[model samples]
Target: MSCSEDPTCQELLDHIYELVDADEDAIDERSRALLAAHAAVCPSCRDAVDAERHVRELLRRCCGESVHAPAALRVRVVSMTTRVRRTE
Candidate 1:
């Protein structure tokens, strides 16, 4: 989190969210590689990058993949499930 007065430091902070998200649509591999290379030489950037990844990892572990709906809710939705045909 010590951004250490580098011009590129702000660049890293700006794109940190897109970088950590790991979505290609959000950030291309080349841009990510450039940022990573910058972080490699800069201790400050490296620490910030690592911390962001760590926080996201912790959230994934704590929340898990998916939650099951309540049994009653599931049953009610199933009962109400229906399809309507459209007339042209």
Candidate 2:
């Protein structure tokens, strides 16, 4: 029921977040290589990694896009910063 019983699976579980990153810098090169090699040979882990990648892509599509602050909020923030600077 869980990967906790197997060291290899545990390793994949531990690094799942890093494995799902779109950028290579999220994980060390050596650790990424080791996990990728492991996933290549392990179907369960490979599927798990694929699932995570899919989820990350979905989230990126849904919530990761950049946005401009609303005009009212931007004005409020600018006002706050101006007051703070004057007080300093």
Candidate 3:
């Protein structure tokens, strides 16, 4: 079934961006299962993930390796991300 037809799949797709931006080593077993199962079987989500990955890679390459944010900015970003995750 398409993700649009399944609530669980839609939820998975909704959070797929978090998966795309996540470091491989940061994913726990359950998170890995969700990503693996849906991304492997869902053609639309697989394509979406691929596109997101490409954009991430391109940005990293274009922005250059080792670009560092100011410490305050980094802290704010982490704090914001944490807050968002908590709310979710």
Top-TM-score candidate index: 1
TM-score of each: 0.60, 0.58, 0.52
lDDT ranking, high to low: 2, 1, 3
Question: Candidate 1 clashing pairs?
Answer: none
**Which numbered prediction scores highest in lDDT against the true structure?**
2
lDDT of 2 by residue, 13-79 (tens): 6777677663577777767777778888898788677656555454457668554445475446445
When 1 and 3 are scored with TM-score, the better candidate is 1
Instruction: Kindly indicate the candidate among 1 and 2 with the higher TM-score.
Output: 1
Q: 1-88 in candidate 3: lDDT tens per residue?
A: 2334333656666665567757566555566566757788887667666655554565467677655446465446545554654588
Model 1 CA lDDT for position 78: 33
Q: Clashes in model 2: which pairs?
A: none
lDDT of 1: 0.63
Worst 10 residues of 1 by lDDT: 79-88
Please tell me which model should have the higher lDDT, number 1 or number 2. Answer: 2
Off by over 4 Å in 2: 1-7, 22-26, 66-88
